[model samples]
Target: MKTKTALVTGASSGIGRDIAMILSKKGYRIIMVARRENRLLELAEKLPGESRIIAADLSRAEECFELYEKVRGEHIHVLINCAGFGILGEFEQIPLGKELEMLDVNIRAVHILTKLFLADFTAQDSGYILNVASTAGLMPGGPLMASYYASKAYVTNLTIAINQELHSAESRVYVGALCPGPVDTEFNDVANSDFAVSAMSSKKCASIAVRQMFRRKMLIVPGFSNQFFVFAARFLPRRAVIATAEKIQSMKREEQNS
Candidate 1:
């Protein structure tokens, strides 16, 4: 029996780190990628199975491609796209540079990596790709985090469409979106937003995400509250959903200012 390899982006901390740990325990050799080499090294040292660290800032397209090339020799059984961040502000108020960077990391990186790996997976007829999106992707619009939400919407939609394509082709490759809401991570500090609601722990979220990935679930929304909100968004009027999202996001923005 050969050990399977799982490559996780944003593995320095938060959801990515937890997911890597879970996969390691589950007997997969882990390849951890992040901007912080030291953190990845530390995480690699603690994993139960064989692990490697590839420190690359995935926000850059060339870097993403380079990272793919570096690991193309390894048979990656699972690919988890968890490298993304958000900027909490009105679309117009946020710096254009920052917004573009967010898109690069949240959308472009996922697209590039998934495309590269999906080809390999389909060729071999077995693999799993878990793209970490957010509940914000389910909403029509997010006022304060507009660009971030839009980027995630791309991830969620792309993952689902690819999953369907695989099913239609009768292929075994699994592609799914992990849509979690407010996981207790460094995201709040990085995004500069305050949470109005309680957050799920990163460990719990990762546990559910990994289990669902193995089951080949299409849309893995972790918590009960997040699942309910995603379901409710589908029934609500688009305008109403957008307005409600704006209100909730605005409250968080206000708290950040206070």
Candidate 2:
């Protein structure tokens, strides 16, 4: 069988970039999407297999439609929604517009693109959808990072629903949610989420996520420690989890300041 094409959003950096590279190495033709045209072009040039650089802000609803149109005519075997960011600090302190943008990118974009591609996938009876959520989505977040957590929670639930629907119908379509802990990426710096110790690398996280995805796992939490924390959060008191997260966030901020 000919290798299928893969579309990865946020393909310019972090986990998204690594995913595109990994899928390409596996002989898939890759379509890289992000707002940075230059970075996407650079990635396209370096990939072993054929790659297309799509420069579009997927945060916009119309752009999501355009993206679907661009690849709808082609054979897309997978869609990876990894274009997301967090704004740290108290919700009231964060700019309203930036928070809304986060919702647009993390939540709305995922929904719209998935809806568009799902129709195609159902018709063909095969495709994979990977939504990059976070460990924060597993629980109620701390004082800071409220909106970010809420958005991820939405992703987690939505991914689960789709996965359930696929399984119920005995379809080959697969959907997985990647709930990783803190990652060592430009995401931290951009979100200003400086911490005492950085988490795993984007490459490592991407590798684990992709592996689980191939296994058709409905959800994946990469690190042992992260899995432990999420498991505890599930049974522990909500206030306790919130307090722990606050302390961790505070320690990170203090370390950055020092």
Candidate 3:
């Protein structure tokens, strides 16, 4: 009997690591992808099921394609796109190179990997894709983290659109977006932002994400608060939503500096 395999990006730490662990416990052979080989090795040793590690920086287009090529032949039962980062600052103050890198990892890499794997999944007629977006994506804009917010919006919208296409085609390939709010992870340090509200545990976030994703839910926002925010944003005027987002981000930035 062939073992089902799940490939998880950003598996070095945080939500990705937690998701990988949960999937491993669920009897899926895990393929961990991240830049930190040592961390991945440590995690692989602890996982209950068999695991493989691929140390590659998905922020580079070449590496993203290379990763696809390496695993294209494997029967991947699931692909979780979670390798992403964010920078918090005024759009004009942020480095263009960093913003581009963020786009590469958060959007371009996701697009490439999804396209590659979706083809395979459709051919096999069974697979699941979970793209980790953010509650920020539901907002009209984010003042301090413009690029990051926009990138997540792309991820969220893209995943939803693809899932619809798959449904219309009558394919069993499930594609969904995990839109978590602030999570208690290294992401705060990496993004250079402070949480304005209480952050949810990455383990809790991952648990909900995995369960909802396999259940074939299209947009899995982890917490009730986050879901409410997303829902309310839909009713608010676009300008008002953008203003609120800006105020929230401004507060976060001030907290980070203080």
Q: Compose the digit string of candidate 1's lDDT tens values, residues 62-173.
A: 9999999999979899999999999998888999998898899999999999999999999999999999999998788888889999999999999999999999999999
lDDT of 2: 0.90
Query: Which regions of candidate 2 deviate over 4 angstroms?
Result: none
Q: What is candidate 2's CA lDDT for residue 144? A: 77
**Model 3 agreement with the true structure over 9-79: per-residue lDDT tens digits:** 99999999999999999999999999999999999999999999999999888998899888876779999
Clashing pairs in 2: 195-252
Candidate 3 versus the native: TM-score?
0.98
TM-score of each: 0.98, 0.97, 0.98
- What do the candidate models score in CA lDDT, each in turn? 0.93, 0.90, 0.93
Q: Model 1: runs farther than 4 Å from truth?
A: none
For each of the candidates, give the backbone clash count: 0, 1, 0
In terms of TM-score, how similar is model 1 to the real structure?
A: 0.98
Candidate 1 has an lDDT of 0.93
**RMSD (CA, Å), each prediction:** 0.9, 1.2, 0.8
Model 1, C-alpha of 162: deviation from truth (Å) = 0.5
